[model samples]
Target chain A: MTHNPTIVVGIKQVPDDDEVRIDPDTGRLDRSSAPAVLNSPDRNALEAALGVRDDVGGQVIAMTMGPPPAADVLKEAVAMGCDDGVLISDIAFGGSDTWPTSLTLARTAEYLDADIVVCGEETTDSSTGQVPPGIAAHRGWAQLTYVEELEPLPEANQLAARRDVEGGYERVVADLPVVVAVAFGENEPRPAGLHRKIYAENEFEPVTVDANDLDIDEETVGLEASPTNVGGMETIEGVDRERTVVDDVDELAEAIRSTEVFA
Target chain B: MTDIDPSEYSDVWVFVEDHDGDVMSVSWELLNEAKTLVEETGEELVALVIGEDVDGVVEEAIARGADRVLVADDGVFEPYRADPYGEQFRAMVEERKPSIVLIGGTHTGRDFAGRVAVPTHAGLTADCTEIDVAEDGVLQARRPAFGGNVLATIICEEHRPQMATIRPGVFEAAPPENDRDGEIERVDVVVEEADTLTEVLERSTGETADVTEADRIVAAGGGIDGDLEPIRRLADALGAEIAASRHAVDEGWVDGSRQIGQTGKTVRPELYVAVGISGAVQHLEGMNDSEVVVAINNDPNAPIFDHADYGIVGDLFEVCPELADALEGAEQPEVTL
Candidate 1:
């Protein structure tokens, strides 16, 4: 029998990008202004993990690290066909930057005995694309980032992925226990089934782990442990355009030509 | 690891990314920017080049204003497997202890820097659009966050080697100084094949050009209705690159690399022409920096018109072909006295 790799896919609840706004006075993101939803790419990551599980017989677990409200994403993951969900949440994990956040997730993955960890290419809110590789680095595991496709070589105990590069794509094969960062929009996430949605909404409760549960040093898992600090923030001022209304395509083309763009 | 004294670190190091034996322009751009930081900090400007047979890259780094160049020329780093490259970089950080490390925010650089920063406990800022040195020799990395709505300046106050990944094309590359001299040192490659868990099996180049580097871009949106021929013709007439909004990319009308938005690549082209795009806030966030924007949409109420310098209300199918013809006619030789 082929080895069933235990896969843990990381998901996050992020503010809807279209609605996200920054407070002009404080230069800080106004989280309350936007409604929270499952990050789009994380949905793809979960879909990727589910696809892997369906191909080979294995358990697909959804994992997330955020505040209490982050559990919604986990329940949503369960509704989408994950076997179980794990939420690493605590007040201490709040204000944690990518470094500590990644460390905590790495420890949680270890605790879960995950053979594969999948993450979105980046969270829409931060768009850092740091956590996936950071998790791998913390645990000394291989990573395949910006992956668009994945094939499980169950017999070889490895996963092969097609990942995006600057101007092209490359195919890579990694040993088990690798972190895969799924590219955004690469796959169509399946809709929640009626039965699964009903069960998830009423009966599903994700396993919650805190800093203490993961044995993470308190000093290394919060804002105090984060190395990068926001020195300041400023809103980008929108430029006032000429807003010249042109009559026809010829006039528009003439206006474009008048600009020094081609020069 | 965080206990290291900040005073112990010295010099500004820029990682020179090598792509298929050629050094990426972003590397030299970083070296140029690092020159100013080194002058303020009273430290040397160093370039870190890691790849197979990187002698040519080393020479370019020195010519581009590197006071010293560190090389890890080995086959193990040929295709940039994260494990070996990260290990080698982490080992160097522990030994040499540079004050600041700047890497190009490319796919390879982002992957390598994120992995190395965790083990080294370095503070890494991503996709920095601007970088400067403070009076105390601290590196101030400023980057856009919250979908380019706000720019955040980040700093590593206590960290020894402050690190940042700079977006390409944000800075200019300095002119080469052929007579410039610099010291070259070899980095000890401690990573072996056994240490690498990932192996690159194959690579295939795509046809789409990098829109981020283009001076002029004609981008289509969902209103194009899955047809790119009109967009391509307009781009060809204008001598511009073809790009698309996230909507068009999701519809499979264009390659993902050609996408521009909050989730896609941020671009600051000289001239941006939006065709049939409604200009969602996310899409505008990516191209708002363009010097001039021209929007063509059937709806005058399209939000894209708010950000555009010029707006034309029409069907893209009609406007595109006409505009292409008009631009082509305008390209004819002018009568001169």
Candidate 2:
């Protein structure tokens, strides 16, 4: 079961949580006036690295850091069949967080020798689940995190998975150069096959890397060594309930026996 | 030079929890938060409490302010399982060194604090909603991430006894005072059935007797998938407590123990309707610390209307039966536990 195992995942284009656009002069979030996609929990972490490359037989790729219009989510992750794709982007990895965007995805997943990385337990535009455990604590590896289910114990090269505990759920096993983070309902991503969308519009070619290309360390990752200090932004507003817009289910069950909204 | 030196540490443990022998109100809210860091650093707040008859839970953690309880007991530390209560609380934190420990994120503190932080490499934050102590003594903690839309604060700073956990209603419980005064002291954990690596076998019992004490909480989301019959007719017109949202348990529509957020179950009832939830941030990190959040949702920019104390925007199929007929014509308080 180990012929194609190259797997990588990690996508992130963002700003299409149904078309984001709030910049009234820099409250930010204008993502160039909306529409960008490929960030629904990193397309459920690239459908869990294409379901661990369709059950332990791999080759999934898909990577991205952003800019150059985030290479259109790497041509939608090579039309969802990913065999390769990379983009680290320049401007010195802009305002990075989740610790230097996890040290630029751990120096591009240790210059792509990655055996399993997958991510997305957070980031619909910096929702911040802390970059897949800060990219498995800067690639020292062995980080499981919230994943939903992953199997393939490859007779102990390890992979068991499950994880979502707090009030129930946990299995854990890990092993092969780990780091997971999954969980966005773990798997819905698929549509994009049309002959791999015409070989991702001309056999895509990314591979960009920067920050003097990976030999890293410009005073601790970025924004002058991030230790997280975002102390502001407060909008929690919903509490005005008082309505009656109905029609039927027997007047919606006689309007729920008569507006007790749940006594 | 706040680099921690409170005499390099001595005692402050806490973990008591119990369960089959009873006593879990988050073990007196971690002994009312380790009696405020053992009265600002004179240290010695100990509790430990593993189980098996546990002498009425070490005289209820020494009447409820534990200056010392310890216990451990045995019979392979009875039913609390999770590798002999995290190896008898990591053998009383390596023979009582304790500079601070606290554990109460429950489900037996994340199964004995994730197997006692994988053999005490230490630094075990887990749930924490808040926990202070840094004048350089450390342990800041403060969790909530992405689903609660960021609050992080952590700090293990060269780990040792800094641990954290903290979830049941995020702190606020120390006020019993039976003329205060304490000390229980039992401590004999020599349990060697090969240190019981998990084998509770069977204990069942959970058909919703404690959705964190529901007083009324209809909740539903991912826009109530395939008709939960108007959320079971608004939880039978407001007798409430149905709850959902981790997108209606990822669209199966419900049951993941009626999922809520930041990994579920943390309701604070008295009324919390929510129907078509759009309040992500880990479902407003478990009902935005619930108290009275209504939110119906048709998406008037739904972040669960920013924290919903009562938002309606409409369309939960005609405002959940007109808010279940305006809460069946209002007037019905006094339902207490």
Candidate 3:
């Protein structure tokens, strides 16, 4: 039997869309006001990993990093068929950008000895596609970004993953001990099994780790060490819409035809 | 006004992106831009070419805009691999003490810029849309952030050499300054074969779309649903290339390479026609610099109209075909690539 490589997926709990509110004063996303939920793309990533687990018969683990409230995303990941879940939650992790976040995750991933590490291309709130690349940098691991599909290559201890390129997909055969930044549509995230959901909800009591646990220098993982910093933010005011209602498709067609914009 | 002393830094360097014998277009673009900056500041525009046949590449750099091209050619530098490239770049910067290092925001550029910036302890602004010297003589690099909704100007005050990745197509290529003369200085690129960490062994370049050379673009957004045959038809009608937002590509209605946004290509077509796109900040950042923008979406409140020269709020399926038909009669414009 082929060796079933261990897989690990990282998830983030974000504010559900309904609860996502803009801070009128700052125009930044109001994380405090929004109710936290599992990151949707991360769920898709978990599904991709689980699909690999099912096909190849391997162990799948999920990990998360956030404040105390981030444990909820771990439970949700476990409920989605992951055999185990780990949460790295601490106050020190607050205000961390992609660099430190990836550093912490790299430490956790190294601890897990995972052959494959999967994560969403970006977080719902930050939305900067930096974590996967940064993690690869921290661990010196090969990164297969914008992964749309994955096929197992057991013989080479590698997987053939397709990354979305400018005009076509770049099929890369990445050796194991790799990090993948998965985008949506690679697979439709499977619904959490009833028994797994029940088990995850009741049995999950998340384990947290602090700065002391990981052997890392503090300057590299926080706002101070971040390469990019948010200068400031302003709320986007809703545009004043001048509605030109067309009663029929002809009027719309005529308007589009007459427009000299593209001309 | 805190004026940066020119004497503080010694040289002006352009990061040359070349593989095998062919130099990337962005390298020439950066040299052209860097030449302008150096000329304006009365500094020498130097090229740091690291690869095989360094002399020929350096001559090419001087032909484009470099005042002096530094050549560090060897077998290890044959391909623009990340580790050696970063090490070489950082070493040159430390040795020569360049005021600013400009890199093209290509795949290899990003890889080298990310690693070199960290080790060199220099500030790096990625995918910068604009680069300028402030009145104080500080290098000001402007880039879109928060999904291109807002533009931020970054500066490196503490660091010696200011670094930035200039996005392709952001600047136009100017003719070479033939009157100016430059020199090529070859250096030792002495890394043993055993020291090489990663081998290119083989590389398969993706089929070229040449979307950047397209005069016109038909970009689809979240508004378009179902089959994309209609969009393709419109693209065919205008001889325009097809592009998409992240949403459309994520839907699997289109390939990822056609994606235009933060994580995708930055296009500056002569005419950009957006179909069913809501004009998200991410999408807008990629195409806002287009010469002309026409938006077609059913939602009147779509954000795309803010930068659009003309907007038609309606079903794209209905309006797209009509637009295609209308363009058939209208004289097609020429795009200077």
Which candidate wins on DockQ?
Answer: 1
Off by over 4 Å in 1: A21-29, B206-213, B249-252, B256-268, B332-337
When candidate 3 is compared with the true two-chain complex, its DockQ is 0.20
Q: Alpha carbon lDDT of residue B333, candidate 3?
A: 57
What's the DockQ for every one of the candidates?
A: 0.69, 0.02, 0.20
For candidate 2, the C-alpha RMSD (Å) to the true structure equals: 21.0
Q: State residue B71's C-alpha deviation in candidate 3, in Å.
A: 4.8
> What is the per-residue lDDT of model 3 for residues B1-337, given as tens digits with 9 covering 90 to 100?
1233445785568888876666667788888887668766778888888888766677778888888888888877865555566567667776777888888876556656655664455556677877887555568887765445456776666455777788776676556655667887876664565643344433445544545557789988877885687688778777789989988978878766567776566788777888888887767777866766777888888777776766777778877786677656555555564
Model 2 error, position A137 (Å): 4.3
Q: What is the i-RMS of every prediction?
A: 2.1, 13.6, 5.2
Q: Which structure is stronger by DockQ: 1 or 2?
A: 1
Which tens-of-lDDT digit does each residue in B1-337 have in candidate 1?
A: 2587889899999999986676767788899988889889889999999999888888988999999999998889988789998999988999999999999987888888888899888899998988999998889999888777678999999876899998766677888998899999997888898778989999876564667778888999999998899998988887788999988986878877787876566688878999999998678877888999999999989989999999999999989989999999665322221
Q: Which residue pairs show collisions in model 3?
A: A27-A235, A165-B257, A166-B257, A167-B257
Worst 10 residues of 1 chain A by lDDT: A20-29
lDDT of model 3 at residue B304? 79
State the lDDT at B292 in candidate 2: 60
Give the higher-TM-score candidate: 1 or 3: 1
What TM-score goes with each of the models? 0.95, 0.33, 0.81
